[model samples]
Target: MTRMNYQSARFLTSAPTLAQCPPDDGAEVAFAGRSNAGKSSAINTLTRQKALARTSRTPGRTQLINFFTLGDDTRRRLVDLPGYGYAKVPEAVKREWQRHLADYLRGRRALRGLVLVMDVRHPLTEFDQTLLGWADDQDMPVHILLTKADKLKSGAAKSALQQVRSRLREWEDLVTVQLFSSLKREGVDEACARLDAWLADPEPA
Candidate 1:
């Protein structure tokens, strides 16, 4: 286990402008996914704190990039990206959100990894493929979390994971994938374990 603490974390907001970001000293792990993909739930589960990321019954509630700081002011952060593929949001607003998201993803120097959450029932939408492609172009490590696994039986969950793996094999970008359910508390520790390993190592200078 990594000898670290997750203390004093909070949701900072829906978007990231130049003035609203945390200092860029430490590595950051960002979360990107479709709306209602259980991102808020996964984030809360990871931090072991309820309401830390503000779950919404409605998709597209998170319209901006939310940032959460972990383990003191040493600069480690968990970034929550705006949910894509939600049809209810205005086209203009979604476009703006996409612009900001792309700029951040392509340009941020402190970003170390991205945790892409997708619904297990409908994993790997077209938007997901584009996001994975963007990450691949940047040579970023991606960890996919198939959320809402509790909605299905073990057999179904296994099959779903295998399906995602097969789809990923077609992509030239190699991304690691896992299954999780916030309601069932499944794969939470394993997800944290992987993140801990990444965060424990210092970024190459």
Candidate 2:
């Protein structure tokens, strides 16, 4: 595959449930985070597009699992998973999405790695740790983006970064953490480097 031109990313499809997702036969990296965590903003910044991934004030506005192909190639994709947090949706629907999200995380063969976005101010939540555990179960590598770094002072952001690292020390070999600011376009290259390595891998298993 040619090197990913993230700028070329465009929406490919959206699936309401795992069963509706695109064919499970290619390399993809999924971005997931809690509500209002700036996952969409990080994606937009990374792709150099203002609205490549929808940004909303309302959390979980789109419960669909959105997929975007790199440079029009379906084999390489970026997935925007539904954000976790307070939503106006029904409990049953939330539960259903959770089931499928877990199923996808645990079994999706095409997934190369996971990009777990999080608010730098609130590094790891209970749900975040739960997702990390799932990643661990499948031996999937995770690169966490502590988004909204711009919200903190230079020294404060670094401190938060260190705290997250310290907490995740046990999973150091499998998880990588970094401070990110979609507003400042910071850490884009570092995140890209990790994504490139994962998406370009010849064999996933």
Query: Which one wins on lDDT?
Result: 2
Tens-digit lDDT track of model 2 for 80-160: 999886678888987877887898898789999999999999878988999999999999999999999999999999999
- lDDT tens readout by residue for model 1, 1-205: 5744544566544455634666665777888988879888898888888988777788887776788777454467788888888848788988887777778888788888889999999999988888888888898888999999999999999999998898888553658899999998899877887777667754643
Off by over 4 Å in 1: 1-3, 11-15, 170-173, 202-205
Task: For candidate 2, give the lDDT.
Answer: 0.90
What would you estimate as the lDDT of candidate 1? Answer: 0.80
Please, what is the whole-model Cα lDDT of each candidate in the order they appear? 0.80, 0.90
Which prediction has the highest TM-score against the true structure?
Answer: 2
